[model samples]
Target: MAGLPSTARVVIIGGGVVGTSSLYHLCKAGWTDCLLLEKNELTSGSTWHAAGNVPTFSSSWSLMNMQRYSTELYRGLAEAVDYPMNYHVTGSLRLAHTKERMQEFQRARGMGRYQGMDIDVVGLEEIKRRYPFIETHDLKGALYDPSDGDIDPAQLTQALAKG
Candidate 1:
């Protein structure tokens, strides 16, 4: 084990997503004398088990915007740092199996559109066209967000650390 430094300009605890992200942003902002202390390997705790689902679907405008920003950040952060974040733009869907669900999706789609998101309440045909192998017989429609996707939390943490 290496000895801890006697002092640091900024000492961040843990090496999870938040900690690494804070470190990265701080360094980007010219705060380079920062230190991060981790009890174990980065993302060895809850971060490794996270689903890493990035979705822009939310009833709250602030949350939706934040998620959208996160998705965009993840899309470019890896390339900027020369690290692979393993971000996949697989998109997301809120399937509607019944008339009530379809109505709900339509309302949510409207909200998304109002908030300047490229969301759509797509029909069964569109869904089938996008995913030919999906078992859509029970689905009426869906609210789709093309920007939604998934990312590897562990890889992202490493990329942040590299920054």
Candidate 2:
């Protein structure tokens, strides 16, 4: 790698997922003279050990959209580049043990539905059927999203840096 440039139109201070993604988007938006400064190697920080769970369910519309876009970008980047992100779409299940939690799940489901997410409120029987490992005796219900999953943060960060 070459030394850092003396001048840049934009300078990013970190090389984690967020910083690298910001650089990538800026470059994509026609800011090729941008530079990223990292005291250590990229993804060596918290990004390297992240769970990398990408869930599209959120109460806020903007956050949901950003997550959806990020998921789509990761999927496309994995296919477009040689890097393997280890991305998975295994989905996520949020269990509710009380009536209040179930109500919260209901609100989340409504919000997800409004934002075009495929979320569902499942009963205890369905939860048991889907997740046989879960003990649903004290559970009221659960929220299930088919688009939620995990990825390898290290690989993802490297991929973004490469982009």
Candidate 3:
């Protein structure tokens, strides 16, 4: 930091994980002079309420790519930044209520397949047996992505800062 200039060429707004991520990436990309402005404490904004569920079953390619990047970045954060980002891989279980919803999930799974994502359309029996905490009666089915899961924001922030 002492070798870099005092003023940064690029400025990032916000202080949440995303903003911190942008700052971290900028530094990693050789833009050490980049700056991030946070009006409040880190995770003071919408990020504090975030569920930290990183998924990869989006229909859009760009969004999916971003998810991919975030997922990978968080997964290898320990090696990349010398600190661990507490990411949970509990997987996501999206239950269905109607036939239409089942169709929608099928379409989503198809789209995920197109994007090379690991997604599957499961039946009510399967979901019920797996989770056992859900109400499947009168429902159609569900879409389960075993790789989807949550993350700890505080540890993630610390990890990024540690880098």
Candidate 1 colliding pairs:
none
Per-residue lDDT of candidate 1, residues 1-163 (tens digit): 5787888999999899989988988988999688998898899778999998889888667887777778878988988889977889988778889999888777767777877778899988999888898889899999989988888898999999987
User: In candidate 2, what are the lDDT values of residues 72-136, reduced to their tens digit?
Assistant: 79878976767767888898889888999888788888877876778899998999999889898
lDDT of 3 by residue, 31-138 (tens): 866777777778888888888888876656678768867777788897777876668877787878888888878887887777667889999889988978877887
> Comparing 1 and 3 by lDDT, which wins?
1
- Candidates ranked by TM-score: 2, 3, 1
lDDT of 2: 0.86
lDDT of 1: 0.86
Model 3 lDDT on a 0 to 1 scale: 0.79
Instruction: Tell me the whole-model lDDT of each prediction, alpha carbons only.
Output: 0.86, 0.86, 0.79
The lowest-lDDT stretch of 10 consecutive residues in candidate 2 is 78-87
Q: Best-fitting candidate, measured by TM-score?
A: 2
Off by over 4 Å in 3: 1-7
